[model samples]
Target: MTPGLRLRTAREGRGLTLERVARATRVNTRVLEAIEQDDVRAIPPRPYGRGIVRAYAAEVGLDSDAAVAEFFAQFAPVPEPVRPAPPAAPRPVRFRPAIDRRWATVMIVVIIAVAAATVVIAVGRRVLERRSEPPAVATTGVSAPTPAATVGTAAPSATPAPPPSSGVIVVLEATRPAWVAASVDGRRALYRTLKAGEREQLKGTDAVRVRVGDAGAVRWQVNGRPPQAMGRSGEVRTAIVTPSTAGSTN
Candidate 1:
């Protein structure tokens, strides 16, 4: 039987009313009903929801640990390992061409000068030959080749990246002051107050769950997923998180 059914069976065996348990445990009557009905979506998510089951089990004299375990068994299997974001592609290199313009202009002027000199020399030689003087023997030798200039430009630089987390990564960015409790793979990670603009990262290889004292005060994300507002300001909420589920307060 499912954890919810188990809880309901245990509660019925004890002849406890949902109202009686709610008053005893200080839990919501609706929540107690949801738990007995196997309506996980109605309860918070695992981990946090597991705590509710523990409290309920204790009130009804059941095995809290086993009930909590059964609640978490519904989640996906433990994650393998954390995966890092892919490296950014290298930036393209482009020459400005501005610095080489002066050199190009100078080369053009020298070519013009060389051509003019050659034409003048040829005319002079023809005139001397016409005057009955032996034509000056033309000397032919290759001019040295120009060396290629190298431009020294560095590749574009990138900013430092954030450190990698080794398990399912859950990020909580608090917009306003609030209380937050979180767990990963049933291991408690954080139970602290988060001031406005504060961020907390939690890790879970199996499953992660969180409870917010004030929903409107925080936004959350998992494994690089889009950030989601927890709820209206002052609303308390809970939800299960996995790499795939991304943990939604709704």
Candidate 2:
């Protein structure tokens, strides 16, 4: 008997209907019936068809591998058809704006003019600042006092020392660009960014408080004391100089 007949006979011997076999094997009832009736065209093609028959045979107590061999011996496998590939899409074109020669020339000239003006202003400002600053005092070398015209002339009495100035005197010198804000005696004194090599001196009766951005870029001194660094670079620091603390370094 054919493989399908053998499967159907085995299933019937076990009291299983086609519908019951279909449910157990997960195969459609119509396909199971077609297999039983030996209708090769009704089943799937080739390996798939053989696989379905194998499952059906195993579910009904027949040898699955042998069943597949026998079914394919009677109905050979059919090859899948080849399909043509779809065509590729076309690429898009990009457009750029047209440049005008007149506009380009005008822009170049404007940029040059602005740069020239900036340089001129910087040079002029430096010149004016130098003119406004106090000139350095020239000192002649020390010379021995002239011999007294007469032996009776006694050496001039020693010059007296100057009296101490009252009030706090704070000096800020910037080695680089730094933001500084200061107050003296509880009133605003100066609040601005100092350019490189700039110096400011402020006086206060009671106290002088100063705040700086870029701490290490600026050095400060109080009451003619030695200069001190505020902190490391890029650090923000504040200090209050009073008459009592001005002389002590801690």
Candidate 3:
């Protein structure tokens, strides 16, 4: 049965009033009524909505986890049709003239001759200058020890910091327009439609819950692994990714 119907039936069977449930759960009466009616727009956005539903289910003596799972499952977005890509256009050709072989050879020979002459002149000047210098007379004396060069002293090394709690990272890219919602460590991180070629990154230590309207339209990488296909075109997919299941396709 739908979560709303189940909740309503349970409430009626137990002879509980909306006001009574609201007072106990600390939720508004109108919000409680909206939950029983399964009105998505009237309900608050997640993770608030998820928490509210879970609390209500628990108050009604139902399995909170199952109720929350089934409640969100009924609201998965419908997939859109995929379109074919357009054809590519052709390119134009261009022409160029060739150089004269004889002219090219003469230019190369001139450059080589000039370079060789310059090198020879430089070496001859250096040799002449060295030969022209006067020789130094030999003399020796005891010299005092030189003081050690003084630079800044070293400081003690600090302890290395601990790693972040986030053990995994997820990158989502849209190849085509699609709707996506994600939660990191039970907190809502993303909730909006993505344009083609757009990308987002999410990190979580415990879990990253994701729901995609068009599974085939989005490419994803977990913990910097290679991008993997999610599902067939127009398929809806929902999954909770943890450190162990970060890179696995399943």
Best by lDDT: 3
Off by over 4 Å in 1: 77-250
Clashes (N, CA, C under 3 Å) per candidate: 0, 0, 0
* lDDT for residue 222 in candidate 2, whole number 0-100: 80
What ranking emerges by TM-score with the best candidate at the front?
1, 3, 2
lDDT (C-alpha, whole model) for all candidates: 0.71, 0.73, 0.74
Candidate 1 structure lDDT: 0.71
Please give the TM-score that candidate 2 achieves against the real structure. 0.34
TM-score for all predictions? 0.36, 0.34, 0.35
As for lDDT, the candidate ahead, 1 or 3, is 3
How would you encode candidate 1's per-residue C-alpha lDDT over 1-250 as one tens digit per residue? Answer: 8878888888889999898997787556777887787777666544556667799999988888987777767856557854333334334435467746765666677667767777787687657534442223444656556555557855444556574344567789998666788877767888876788999988777567788866777898778778888887646687676543443323
Candidate 3 per-residue lDDT over residues 131-229, each given as its tens digit: 443332334656656555557855445466685344778899998776689988768999976789999999888677788766787898888788876
Return the number of clashes found in candidate 3.
0
Score residue 82 of candidate 1 by CA lDDT: 43
Name the candidate, 1 or 3, with the larger TM-score value: 1
Pairs of residues at least 3 apart in sequence or in different chains that clash in candidate 1: none
